[model samples]
Target: MKTKELLFGACLCMFTACNMPEKGMDVDVYEALDYCDAQVQRTLTELKAAEGTIDYSMMPRNIMDSLNTWHCRKATKDEWCSGFWPGVLWYDYEYTGKATIKEEAEKFTEPLKFLSQIPAYDHDLGFLIFCSYGNGYRLTHNPEYKQVILDTADSLATLFRPRVGTILSWPRNIEMFGGHNTIMDNMINLEMLFWAAKNGGNPYLADIAVSHADKTMKYQFRPDYTSYHVAVYDTLTGDFIKGVTHQGYADNTMWARGQAWAIYGYTVVYRETLDPRYLDFVQKVTDVYLERLPEDYVPYWDFDDPNIPNVPRDASAASVTASALLELSTYLPGKKGEEYKNAAIKMLASLSSDKYQCGKSKPAFLLHSTGHLPNNSEIDAAIIYADYYYIEALVRLKNLIENKAVI
Candidate 1:
């Protein structure tokens, strides 16, 4: 597929940039990657200078301060975002082939190995290990990274309940949620299971991944295919209880990131399994999400948010779904493939523009991501995963332009 990223995107036609392909994509993929290379190194240097000493526990999470510098919300990562920093480094290394970037990638990645030694501390092990070590191994063929990924996959599998047919998202929340809880976010983590299962980890890891996907597909989405952020199940009966949201606007609302996960997760499942079932299902999910987007193709943090134009926009959602669509496009034929690819190009264009690109204000790639509005935390911030997925999508786009697979 061609990148279709040349010529001009008129400033006057900014809102319609995605549709005006004759104007071309607003940003060039290589140019964006070059921007990422500078920003990643600068962010790391700034992060280290601010830190004074290297603390493996603390990773860059967001830009929430008055100075517009990246900061970690926690002293350590109990949150799911820690892996994204290293993951960004690894993707940068993959794109640039700079030995310095690769060396930096290894430095950031190796510290995450502790994630493998622990019991499943909820279902975030995949985000922690796979994004960091998984990418490290994929690029470097480091046997040690492979062992860690395998060990961490096994660690993550402990959360899978045979009765629930899905991984328990938060064990601590079981009593609060009143059942075996699985979140839509958990779908993205299954890639580690699928990868590990085929690559020297327990073979059942793939079964576990498939089982989780199948079960999530059954219970997590609404009849219209819009998804809830969380799905609670009866622990004893293995029956679905209700669909809800933790980070979304309301219980009945379609959380933007949650639905993005559905789009992305199912695409990955289809890639690994080549199942027409997931292919059809993901297209439905993608269509609904695409249909509801704002003029720029970026989504409000929640599709059902009553505020509409007043709400925070989530660049992270757009970037993640864009990356997924690039891969998903490769799997289809004819007009549908072109449609998805064009939609993704539009998203990258919007994200790459001055409206969202972080520029000089913050060291990260894009801005205006809502982490949890309800919790009043990191609202409209420059989040690490947003940068991770944004760069990942750029890398994928470059790969596609060169007639290569996104993987």
Candidate 2:
């Protein structure tokens, strides 16, 4: 009898050990905030030094790596990534209340005012204008910022084709994407439209956002909820052409960031519209995302990439997912909510570690983000949007801990 009891006890111990959470899974919010603060200060110092050396003739594009050296580039106002830098500064100021950060935010934002007047720009107006001016209006309630946001929303709404029932993402002039290409990334831009309608813009702007989301819902996803990176449509006939994974491994494969965008986008849509369909959609997508995540809670650039364990991970996707999951937790009930919250916590813990978070030596905060891996572009590098969403996630977590309202 004694021998049998000993064996049973040993088996129970093994089961308990197997169920333990990974290291860094239980992150302290205070510590995470401290880490973010230090990183932001380091990034500020790096930017100050860069201002003297890097030419900002056009606008700050991204931190580029050449022969292991990182530098910024000047890009056109229509560049998709133009707003991320200013948006980062605004976020830092929001979190730390640092006047220096606020001053820099205003300085960077000044150049982007012209974007609001250019209606011919593509679907990136939200990433270009809203991330900067939308956050500005949220914090300061500045009337000028509000006007720019309203104008940009109107400009973005112009891209919506009633026949296609979706906003055109890439212009027809871009030969690669054809005339009417819509991408999963465009879902992130809808927040600006939702905000515009809620504030002062036309209600039809919100309708446009809903229509685009509904169309994406109908056409962009596969049977298992993994999404295609791009969907092509005939502009004149409003006919479905084909769905392709332009940045992914193949047409049927899942791009990590594209899936992240779908999950985050639907969560925001549900937040704004309170439509049960959006919530259900978010749950389905989130389930697939959580199940496919690596042991570290980070995901490879492409889920279908044959490389599997050897591929580059996209920390940006993880950051975006973590932020979305935090909001999603609030909307869900009981075990489901706790499960998502825990998953987000695990992702944050992994992202905050030395492997993913950049040190003071680097200009950017988050590292190992894979952007366009198939194109051999920006692979395993620091991306500004990654840092933006990381900080945003941390702030949201902190707010949740403090029982404050989270946006």
Candidate 2, residue 90: the lDDT equals 82
- Taking all chains together, each candidate's TM-score versus the true structure is 0.93, 0.89
Which 10-residue window of candidate 2 scores lowest in summed lDDT? Answer: 53-62
Off by over 4 Å in 1: 1-22, 50-53, 73-77
Candidate 1 CA-lDDT value: 0.87
Say which candidate scores most in TM-score: 1
lDDT of 1 by residue, 1-407 (tens): 13334323343245334322345544588888999998987887786756475555568898863548878643233767878888999999898899988977888777777778877788888888888998999998999999999999998899999998999999999999899999999999999999998999899999999999999999899889999899999999899999999999998889999999999999999999998999999999999999999999999999988889998999999999999999999898778987898899899999999999888888899988888889998898899989999999988887776567778
lDDT of 2: 0.82
Clashes of 1: 0
Q: Residue 52 lDDT in model 1?
A: 71
What are the clashing pairs of model 2? none
